[model samples]
Target: MKKVILTALMSCIFQFSNAQNDIRIGGMLAYGTEVENIGIGVNAEFPIIEKLTVSPSFIYYLPKKVSGVSINWFEFNGNANYYFLDEGNINVYGQAGLNYTNVRLSYDGAYSGFLSSAASDGRLGLNLGGGANFQMGGNILPFAELKYVIIDEGQLVLAAGVKFNL
Candidate 1:
């Protein structure tokens, strides 16, 4: 299942490369309580239709000690964003999508344990969020976003980044 999803995502990126009206690539700093850590991410926004865009993002959280366990986390998401105000320097948008998250845990200097087993499982979740885009002169846009992840235990994410139009 993971392989298929990854293949499809890669295909979409290549297929849309030439046809997309606008493409923005950027990096973000993310914080979420589920991982109880800060993460770094890269994202690309591709226009799909009028006032609508598709964004693919990946985030990696550094290993951190939490509750006596060391944890490392990562996530991949594909989101659809609808711009409420598309024709201005400032745009507010709503986004909804799906994400796949993977976590690894270590305890007592060993990786084989209940926490490791549970954390190694892949989780699929829903992502809902909103953000604002501040377009600077030319092709630079700085953005801030907030998103919620609905899974076993819900998580809230806050991210900020710069988008470069291509």
Candidate 2:
């Protein structure tokens, strides 16, 4: 009876330890001069399994143009992140994703030549970064992150967002 009880207790503890899963919704700003120019985005993440998360994001930007003209672009993207070190208040991860981009250019006031020109493209890239989470109250983690990715041109994206553990 003692042996059976010990085995059951160990199994319960192991299962509880493995049940650490969560989802996060947040916003970010991204810049890729050769592509979307500049964009502000919102993103959400869900952990499908241990150490891996699936994220989907959307971004919108208006690029400064010559002669009072500006261009607008929107991007839809998804990524998979693998956490290499998941411990304490700091975590390290690597990510890869695909982006579907819609590019539009517009002119105002004086420039008549530029009028809502648009282009759409698909891009694939990889990202790597690490972040520290500062626990602010229960279930809320304020984090600072730095990541680099390449979508035809190289980009460095720095972000500060909150993570919600579900």
Candidate 3:
């Protein structure tokens, strides 16, 4: 089941990247509760049309320790965004996409089998968000975004980074 899902996601990523005017690479640094610590995410967007873009991203969170248990996670998401206003250095847009979350765990110090617990799981996520692009120079712009993902407990991510128009 997991293999099938991952395979499908990989297929979509390749197909999307090969498709129109988009920012090729971008990333963000942020702090959040749901992430349990500091996190970083980077994404690449391929424009499918004038107003539509396809984005694939990867996010990683720092490990959090609790009761001798440490946990960390990373996920890959493929998203679509529509730019309502793509003018000057300011661009406002709405986005949505399918996200695949792969959660992993690592134990620092050991204990009983039941006491030291770890598991690998995956989930399907939905993303809804918006952002602003501030032109920094000619082909480079710094941007800030607020994104929310619907998963088990709902994850909210606030990120800012530089995007290069391609």
Worst 10 residues of 3 by lDDT: 108-117
lDDT of 2: 0.64
- Give the TM-score of each candidate: 0.79, 0.65, 0.77
Residue-pair clashes per candidate: 0, 0, 1
Tens digits of per-residue lDDT for model 1, 39-142? 99999998876578899999998788776777889999999999997657889999999999998776663444543333467899999999999978888889
**Which structure among the candidates has the greatest lDDT?**
1
The TM-score of predicted model 1 comes to: 0.79
Tell me the tens digit of each residue's lDDT in model 3 across 1-166.
Answer: 9999999888777766655344568787755557667778888877775578787888887777776667777777788888899787688888899878777776634455554557888899998898777876777768887788889997887778877777
In terms of TM-score, which candidate is stronger, 2 or 3?
Answer: 3
lDDT of 1 at 16: 67
Candidate 2 lDDT over 44-84, as tens digits, reads 77766667778787777656665554556566767777778
Higher-TM-score candidate of 1 and 2: 1
Q: CA shift at 50, candidate 1, in angstroms?
A: 0.8
* Candidate 1 ranges beyond 4 A from true positions: 1-19, 108-119
- What CA root-mean-square deviation does each model show from the true structure? 8.7, 6.0, 9.3
